[model samples]
Each structure stands twice: as C-alpha cells, then as structure tokens.
Target: LEAYQKFVFEEDRLRSVQIAHHICSLMQRGNVVVRWKLYHSVFNPVLQRGVKLAHHCQHSSVTSAQMHSCPHHDQCLPQEVLQVYLKTLPALLKS
Candidate 1:
C-alpha cells in the first residue's frame, strides 16, 4: 500500500512538472492575451492539482520547492514578459 501511494505521488509530481514546462514554452511565444489565456487554461489547473497533491501528502515543502523552481515561476510575471511584448507591439501594430 505504501509503495503504491508513493508511486501515485511521484506520478502526480511528474505531471505537475511537465505542465509547468508546457506553460513556460507557451509563454515564450504569443501576445499578452494569448499568454494569459494559456495560463488560465493550462497553468492554473495544474497548479491546483499540485496544491491538492501537496495537501494530501501533508508535506507542503516537497511541492513548494518544485513549484518555485519551475521556469514559469521566475518568468511568468507581467513585468518580465510584458516589457518585451510592449517593445515588439509597435512593430506588430504598424504592420
């Protein structure tokens, strides 16, 4: 039973990590609205799953570390992506 539970937990963690990476890749392209949509559609659900799994495991630190280290955690902020988006918008809007 313990081993089965461990396998399930690891599988959930792996899925969460994969989702985070997918979010990062999507964010690297597209406009602000597109990125925000991807966040809502993709990132938030996975994040909720991770939270639930962490809560169930009663080891918040285990998931927290993985969440923090996700590339999106560092790069998901508006200030980071928006600056680049804004700079390119002028050219895009002109075309």
Candidate 2:
C-alpha cells in the first residue's frame, strides 16, 4: 500500500509538472502580437473555463493529491504558466 501510494503521488506530481511545462512552452512560443491575439481571442474563454474548473478541482471534495494530478479540464494552466504570463504583463500593458 505504501508503495502504491508513493507511485500515485509521483504520478500526480509529474502530471502537474507537465501541465506547468506545457503552459510555459506555449508562452515561450508566443510573441507579443500572438500573445495579444491570444489574450483577446483564446485566453478569455480559457480563463472563464479555468475558473469553473478551479471551483471543482481546487475546492471540491476530491483529494488535493488527486486534484494536483487530475487537473480539471478547464484548469489547464499551472502556476509556472502564470509566471511567464506575468513576465509579459509590462509589455502587454504598455501596448
């Protein structure tokens, strides 16, 4: 049981890391123009969905351990992604 629990925990952590990395990759590939278009077009809807997902994934009864791995479909972006997003904020705000 201990081994199984460890395995599950590791899997969850890996999934969370993958999600974070994916978001970072998306940001890295995105240029200022692309980011703006993304912000205007895609991000809003994604953010809305993320909010709903957060309610379920972060706040629901499910174990935090599971939630970390089985991220809500809407809550795809991770904190790392948000960090990259913030790095672009000054330029975005200037524009």
Candidate 3:
C-alpha cells in the first residue's frame, strides 16, 4: 500500500486505472472496506477515462491467439493501432 501511495502522492502521478485496479485486486484479496471504497468512488471514473482515450484508438475487434498490445494507451496521440484496454476487458481482473 505504501508503494502505491508513493507512486501516487509522492510522485504526483495520477495513474487512475492502475490505482483503481490495485484497489480492486485488494478487494478480491478480501478487504471489505477497500471493496466498498472502490465500488463507491474509483471504478466508474477509471472506466470513463478509458472510454475517452478509446476515442483516439481503433477499438479493435480482430480475433487472434496473440492480440495487439498498446503500451501508450494512456496518451492521446493518434496511432496506427492503439488498443484501449479497460477494466471491463473479459477477465482482466481475474486471478
């Protein structure tokens, strides 16, 4: 938790998706309060951010055993193939 806090607060970084996913992962690890806070405050906003960024992306629908990976989905510059992976991605949060 302290490492996450450092990456967020100390570094003045707002990695909303990572932070939200981490909190969700903690919830999956069985923390009632963290789950409550994530559902109440964090989840939707991160998805919204992904949706906004997806506009600049292609919204891929291709089927392949190994799919495309976009490293810079967090940015807004146009690219040939920008995969906007979000929280709702099939079983992303599954362990």
Across residues 10-95, which tens digit of lDDT does each residue of candidate 3 receive?
Answer: 22234533454456566566566765565445444445544555543545542232123544433431221112224333433553
The Cα local distance difference test for each model comes to 0.43, 0.48, 0.42
lDDT tens per residue, model 2, 15-77: 544444444355457787766555655444435544555566656665545655664533444
Task: Write down the lDDT that model 1 would get.
Answer: 0.43
Clashing pairs in 3: none
Q: Rank the candidates by TM-score, best first.
A: 1, 3, 2
List runs of model 2 lying over 4 Å from the truth. Answer: 1-35, 68-95
Using lDDT as the yardstick, the better of models 1 and 3 is 1
C-alpha TM-scores of all predictions: 0.40, 0.37, 0.38
lDDT of 1 by residue, 22-68 (tens): 44555556678866675566544444544455454354343444654
Which portions of model 1 miss their true places by more than 4 Å? 1-20, 59-95
Give candidate 3's TM-score.
0.38
CA-RMSD of model 3: 8.6
Error of 2 at 63 (Å): 4.5
Ranking by lDDT: 2, 1, 3
- Model 1 lDDT-worst window of ten: 74-83
